[model samples]
Every structure is written in C-alpha cells, then in structure tokens.
Target chain A: MEQSYLIDLKQVVKRFPMGKGSFTALKGLDLQFEAGEFAGLIGPSGSGKTTLLNIIGTLDLPSEGGGTVLGHPIEHLKASEAALLRKERIGFIFQSYNLLQVHTVFENVEFPLLLLGMPSEERRKKVMEALDWVGLADRHRSRPSQLSGGECQRVAIARAMVKQPSLVLADEPTANLDAANSHHVLKTMQQLNEAFQTTFLFATHDEKVISYLKRKIYLMDGQLVKDERV
Target chain B: MKLAWLLAWRNLMGAGLRTFLNVLVLSFAFVMILWMEGVMVGWDQQSKEDMRAWSIGAGQYWHPAYDAYDVLSLTDAHAVIPKETVRSGLVPVLATQASLFPQGRMMPVRLNGIPSQQSLLKLPTAALDTTMDAIPALMGTSMASKVHLNRGDRVLVQWRDRNGTFDAMEIELVDVFQTTVPAVDAGQVWIDLSVLQELMMLPNEATWLTMGEATVDSERMAPFVWKPFSELTRDIDAMIETKSSGQAVFYVVLLLLAMLAIFDTQVLSIFRRQKEIGTYVALGYTRREVVWLFTVEGSMHAVLAALLAAVYGIPLLWWQSVVGFTIPMDTEGFGMAIAPTLYPVYSLGLVVTTFVLVLITTGLVSYWPSRRIAKMNPTDALRGKIQ
Candidate 1:
C-alpha cells in the first residue's frame, strides 16, 4: 500500500552529549504529517522543537527509533543520500536570514537551481518567478548586505522556494523580523502553501506565527502536551 | 568543478582589496623567479662563449709533461712540434715562467708564445711581429694596469732556456689588449713564438698546440695528448653551476613569502566564513564539495597572478633581455669570464615550470586550511557558531 503521510515518526528520541552525561531533547515523540499540510511545532525554549525540526529535515537522525520521510527511512540514509533528499525534495529557511552575504539576490535564488544542473535559460525563468513570489524581483541585483531585514528574509524565501521542493523546514523564521514583516513573510508562505500544495513545517513560539498555522502542536520540556486545529 | 570555479571567482572578486594584495604578491614572485633564472642561464652561456673565443679554441693538444695545475711541470712541458699537427692549422703555443722588472717593480708572469700570423685566437698577436729594437711583446690590459706598463715601454724580462740557463732581455710592450677571460689575461704576457723559441734555445718546441679546425683526430696527435673542448672548459662549467645553485636560495625565499601571504588569507577566509560554509551545505553541497570550493578559490589566485604577471612582466623582461643589465662595479678581478653587461635569456621551460610549481603550492596551502571544514557540524555552522 502507498503511504498516506509524507512524514511518519514513532518514538523518536534525541539525546545530546553534555559534560560526562547526556541531555535528552526529545522523549518518546511520535508525529505524522501528510502532504500539503501547513503546521507549526509550538514551544518555549529548550522544549526540543528545533531538534524535532532538524530530524524531520534530515539534518540529524534520532538517537533511537526510526522514521520514514518521503518514502526513505531517515535513520538509515547515508550522508550523501540525505544530501540528495534535501537537494531535490527539501528547502530550509532560518530566522537570521542566512543568505550568502556576498551574493546578489538573483544569484542567491539561482544557487539551488544551479545545483540541479538546470539549463541557464530555465534557471533564469525559475529564479525570476521565485523572486516575484516574494515581491523582490526588482531588488534581485542587490546584495543581502544592501537590503533591509525583511528584504533579506524575502530573498532567503526566494532561495528556498526556487526549486519548489515538496517540503519547507523553517526554524524560527520570523524571530528576527518585526510584526509587520512577520505577517508579510507568513502571508507569502500561506499563499505558496495553498498554491503549490507544498507542505510547510515551522518550529516557533511566536504568537503571530501560531495564529497563522492551520494546525499547531505544542510541546513542553521535550514532551508533546497538546495538539490543536484552528 | 565549474560551479566551484564560478563561485570562487565571484567570492574572490567580492573580496576586493584583500584579493588584489594577494595576487600582487604572488605575481611579484612569478616575475622575479623567471628573471633570476634567466640571468643564470645568460651567465652560463656568456661564460662559455667568452672562454671559447678568448682562450680555448676548438680544443688543444698538451705536451705529455704539461699540467696547467702543476707549475713545476712547466720546466719540462715543451716538446718538438709535430710537422703533421702544425700543417693541420694548429697554432703552436709555448708557455714558460718569466720575471719582469717593470718601473723597477719585480713581478712573476706567465709568458705565452704564439705564432704572430695565427688567427686561431682573438689575441692581438700580430702586434708581436714588430721589428722594434727590443723584442716585441703583448700584455693584457689587466696585466699592464697592474704592472703600470704602457705601449712601447721596454720591460726587463728573465726566463730559463732549454738547457737550464737563465737569460734576461728587455722586451717592448707592442700592444695592450682587453679581454673578458681572466684565465688568459691576469698575470700573463704574450710574445712571438719564433722570438721566444730562439731566446730559450728551444727551436721547434711548443708547450701546447691550439686547434684552429672544428675537429681533429686525437690518435694522429700522438705524443701530444688531445684535450677536447668539454674537458678544457670543465672548470668554467663548474663555477657557473655553483653560481646557479647560490641563486636558487633567493628564488626560494621569494616563493615562500608569496606562499605565506596566500596561506594567511586562506586561513582567515575559512575562519570568518563558517556560516557561509554551512549555507553551502544546506544548499545541497557536501562538506567535501565545500572543501573543494575553497581549494579552487585559493588555486585561482595563482591563475590570476600568472595572467597579471604576463601583463607587466612580458614587456619589462623583454626590455631587460634586449638592453641587458650592466654591473656597476668591476668584475674582471673576479678571476672568471664575465661580460660587463649581461643579457637575460628566458626559455619557455623556465616560465612554465615556475607557474606550475606556484600553482600547486597555492593549492596545497589553500587545501590545508580547508580540511577543517569537513569536520564541522552543519547545525553549528549554520548558527555561525565556531566548532
């Protein structure tokens, strides 16, 4: 039978070594996400939300237990296989707007497509479309250092969305943005989610971001406490 | 690899001043190395040519008793000239030790006797054919300067005859000539072969015969041992090789300075760009790929430097080769043949070898610092946290 969910995790436990002992970040966590879902993992600091997000992104693997993401067992994937999974199927956005500071907005958005070995003409078209989606088409020539914080984040969004990956993993994507820029970034994400049916998973505690998620899963002290659908 | 090159080039260009400084230092090294090596080659070639023209003709045949290194052998070095060898255009040279009293100052000098009409050597021997009241002789400018003797000046000369009898006579300095070869000029005097043979009572005897022709059969030269050109000029070749070795140290120091500048920049770039490295990982590059990217970036500096060197170095080096570099101080006293002005000769091999060596070295130093990136955690790197 075909899998119904794009991500399926069971009893995923994550432990990090600290001093002579270990600190457990996630305890017996089970989660699932279907295609095209717009969801958030809501929590306070040290509640293991980002750690869970990293696992789902395949940036990390669970210390114990295993999960399947997009049909591949995440725990057993080699480093190269994980990189290919991210390259073709996943996109990441960070809060501080981790754009290559030296590259222009157009070049930054064009990076993922270049990695895909897309022809130059096709890459230019896709990069332009992605920049237009974030309302930064006119600022494509400006470097990240030359742009405002919101503009920098939008360029990052353009970079992540350039390849139109099936899943987008965002960690505190609005933590550095003001109220107005946060709403603008969220609306951009909301529209992209509904338009392409791409799954959006965010790890955040921001109220503005929480209100925008269709489903919110709350965690406390490394354990899930509540799940709600608005 | 192409993507790495494109990104590396852009990154270096974005660096602006820092990149310019590195390329400038490396290009300076490139030009200097080629210039110095070219000079060494020029010196080697000049020395050989000067030696050939000024003293060692095609080759020589030494009397069996002759040993240039052993002064005592000169007494018995002379032998009867072979008729066949003399007929084959070989110029007989008779050498004997003599004492000269010039301006009341006594000095010992090597007296060389050559056929006045011979054209096998570049010496002004024809001047020795004069019928002056005193026996005519020639002195190198160096020897004349040291003895303070001028043209037409008579100096008292003393020598031993074939019968071991000491004889003295006044010889007029017919001419004072200039030559670059110190071996033939320093502490030496030249006179007509017939005059010296009659004076020494050793007619038809010669210490050595210089060949005017390009090739001669050593077997026919019998009692006189033939010395080929290679054997005759071995000392000059050795001295030049030693000089070339000494020059290698200077080139090494220059290359090291450029390498250090490049290495320092690469280390700083890697240290400061951890976040950028992590971003590359998130954008689908493996840690190995990122390492390769940085390595290529560093190697590109060498490529840029080579191009930059060609821009300015070509015209400058070509001008030097054409105009030549003149030594400010006197070198005739250095006891070797050295022209006043040295024209550098750059071979295609020299330029290519230097460029390839510097490129590989730059790649190594760049790769050395880049290896640290392979061990970094993507999560930590993405957060700009040093690990």
Candidate 2:
C-alpha cells in the first residue's frame, strides 16, 4: 500500500541577517516524507541540514515559500497554532539529550504527558511504557547525570515517545555517543520504529547515522544534492 | 502549565547559587522596605500622641481680646475664663511665667494653672492620688532637683498682672513629676487655679481655659471670645507638612532603588537562562506560555520575599517600640520637650502597601525580559544564542 505524506516541503527558503548582509541558510529546497518512514538528512557542517530539520519541526518558519506538516500549512500557521501542532503531533530529540538535569529519567519522560494534563496514574503508565520500550525501565529513577551516554540517550528516546507523537525529529542523536553506545542507541530507535511505525527524521553528518536510515536526503552548501530510497 | 512550572522549578533548583542569590537579594529588599515603613508609621503615631499631650486636646485656647504682640492678661482673667466654662465642657487652665525663689536661688518657671477638678482629670495618673482634692503643685523633677527643693519646700513666686503691675505669692511644692518626654520635665510647674488667680491678683478668675475634649460646636467658642491652641501653634502645621514631604521624598528614592535592584536581578536571571527558555519554546511551549511561566516565577519570588519580610519585620518593629531610638538631648532646648525615645507603630495598611509595592516592582521587572524570551527565535535559542 502507498503511504501518505506526513511532511511536505516545496521551494522552502530560510535566511539570517548578518552584519549588514544576509546569510542564506536554505535556498529553494523541495522535500517530502511519507508517514511511518525512517528518513535520514545527511550533510556537511553548516550545510543547512539542521535548518531544514528545524523548519520541518515547526520550530522555525521559512523566510519564503511554504511547507506542510501533518497536512497543516506551516507558513500560514500562527506561532500558537504551530506550537500546538508541535505539542500534539511531534516530538524532538536533541544532540545533547536535553533532559532537564533536575528531573530523574521517569520524570523527564513524564513531562509531555503532564503538559497534556494527564492524570498521575495515566502519566505514570505512559512514561513507564515508553521507558520499557527504550529498555530503560530499571534506570527510571536515575538523573541524567547519573546515566551513561547511552542510558541518557535512551532516556531522551523515552521522553520523546511517551507522548506517542506521530513524528520524531532528532538532531544528531548519536553525535556525543561512543561507538558502542551509538550502536545501542541506533538499535533501540530501529526497534521503536519497527514496533510503532512512527515517522523518524534525523539530521546528521555522521556516516554511521546515515547508514541506519531506510531513506536518505543529502544536502551540499544549502542545496539538495541527492534523494535516495533504500 | 504544570509542566512549565515543573520545568521552571527544576531549572531553579539546578541553578542553586543563582537562585539563592536572587532570593537573598529579594528578601533583603523586602525587609528593608517593611522596616522603613514601620519606622515611618510608628513615628507618625508617636507624633500625633505627643501633639495631643503637649497641646492638651486636639484644640487649644487663649484670650481672644489680647493681640499677639500685646502683654497677656494676668488680672483680666475673667475676660477669657467664664464661670459657665465647665458647663461648656471646656477644661480651662491659666498659663503664665513666674519668678521662683527656691532655697534663695532665683529661676524662671512656667506656671500652668489648671482648674482643681480639671487638673486632676488631665494630669497623668502618676501625678495624683485617687481623691478629687488638689495635690500640692506639681514641679518638674529637673527644676525641683536644680533648686534643691524637697517635697515640702516652699517656693516664692512673683508674676505681672494684666495692668503690668507685679504681685508675689508663696506655694508649697508637693509633687515632682518625670517623663520620658524631656522638655516637659525640665521647666513645667503645675499649680491650682485658685492659687494662680490670687497670686496674679485675679482672685476669682482663670487666665486661659483649656478644654480637655473637643466641644460639640467649637465654632460657638469662636463667638464667646477664646482662641484655640490650633491658632497659637500655627507653626506646627508647617512642621508636619515639611516632615510629611521629606518622608515622601525618602520613600520615592527608596522605591526607585528597589526597582533598579529588581530590574537588574530579573534581567540577569533571563540572560543566564536564555538557553533554557529557548529550549522550552522549542519543546512546543508558545511565547505566551513562556512569558506566563516567567511571570509566575517572578510572582513566586515576590510572594516568598514578602513572607520572609513579614516574619523579620514584626519582631524588629516590636523591638523598636520597646527600646526606642534616641536623638541628641542638647539639640533642642528645654521648654520644648522632645521625646528621648521614639517607637515605631505597625499598621496593617502600611504592611499591605509595602507588599503591593514589592509585587508590582517584581512584576514590572520581569515584563521586558519575559517579552524578550517570547520574541526569541527557537533556532537561535536552541543554539544558545542571546542578543
């Protein structure tokens, strides 16, 4: 069966003002990702890969042209509506595993559900289920600092998936991990993707990350160089 | 909303030293404001009471017939003091200066001739016995000690009459009074009206009739021929106005300083948390949510500071009341009794005012920075970019 497009971008552009000049970050790019697709965005440093991911994540607006996420026009969405879309339909995974340092693993995972005003019992059930899926059930009570690099990323994954968002946008997920931890994190993400069939969009320059995706989009100097399906 | 609060609280806890410093500075400012307000309120209350005691009632009296420059009446006491004075509910007293010869040393004394009945009622309880009969004339302890007059000593008094003729009489010093109010204890001599009338050659009259309480129609006293004390001490009105204005200026300066401190603390807090605030926005929290989060945090700090201030303020106020603050004795001279100790009185209105002032300052200080947080681009915020 053919899949439906979860995110679609056409002629998207982003620019930043710099010292009386403008730096064009993304220039007239077109992209599309289907629902339940495990896609990778691969590029060199400063090649606008992260900028594209941010635009897709509804964290930034295109300077010109438009895009759609979950069938909603990104350009026309107000800030509040964009935030609501992000809250209800999307999850984010940062390169640094941006877990609130003061909260334990369980609490971190419980955050989004709490924002949704879930009851304590419902929140606990969802958070533990996410942690169980990420294989961090035993470490739920530990703080981020107390965890290893791999454990912290697992906690981040649990936090991302606890709300069961339709799409997960991860920025350099294994950038800070060692070889063994990176392998473990990639394996866990793959397991989650196969089990839940949630769409995963990863932005990275690392070959190890690029090799893990079923589909890959390549960019060079703010322009798309290749789009590949595996 | 709960998530934001949880995140804010977590961030606050994570940044322990920063949060502690902010709380300390905030609480200190709160305490200082409350303490200053307490002192001002206490001083105002003390001033009002002192005014009442020094001037007798809220009103005063003098002979309407005599001009400010004219010699005061000593013999024509009836012109000011009427027979139906008590019926009018006015407490009448005769005030004049007399030459005192005590143990052969001469000194000037202020003789306050109060009616025998009214004097007993108005005098502080410490000065008189339970009986309605007259106690021997009350002399200030300082004056009594200076002249070496014991309780039974006789002092010769001389005074001028309304016609500028002089007369002399003798009175026994029976009671000595002392008060924390310094000026009153230095030169006052309280005497009976009958003795003062005979001594000044106005045998059946009183010189100045002072009312203990305000008359129902003080305007009636205007036509009956007596000037109120309010007219005699017109300078006090100016003094009170000057003091009030000075206090206002001081409060304004203090408030400005407090606002600056609050503003500085909030700006610094936002600057330090730029990354965190950005992260929150990037994590699906709207700008309004972010602004509201910071606002709630600021309000929490303000409320905590106010609570701490109240805890510290009440005891400090009580201490001030009990011990009192002293001013230089030699600065103001004898006839004007300045209180040696001043106490601050606490009022609910003052407390509420201080709390509101602090809350408003905290809220305003948080506004601009929270707006900045709201306006920030999530991409920049995520990259820890601050402008």
Q: What are the per-residue Cα lDDT tens digits for candidate 1 across A52-107?
A: 98888887889998789888898898878888888888999998888887788999
iRMS for all predictions?
Answer: 1.0, 1.7
lDDT of 1 at A50: 90
lDDT of 2 by residue, B341-368 (tens): 6666667786787778778877777676
Per-residue alpha-carbon lDDT of model 1 for B242-281, expressed as tens digits? 9878988987888789889888998898888988887888
In CAPRI terms, model 1 is classed as medium
Considering every candidate listed, which one attains the maximal lDDT?
1
> Per-residue CA lDDT of candidate 2, range A14-54, in tens?
99899999999999999989888899889989899999999
Give residue B199's lDDT in candidate 1 (0 to 100).
Answer: 86
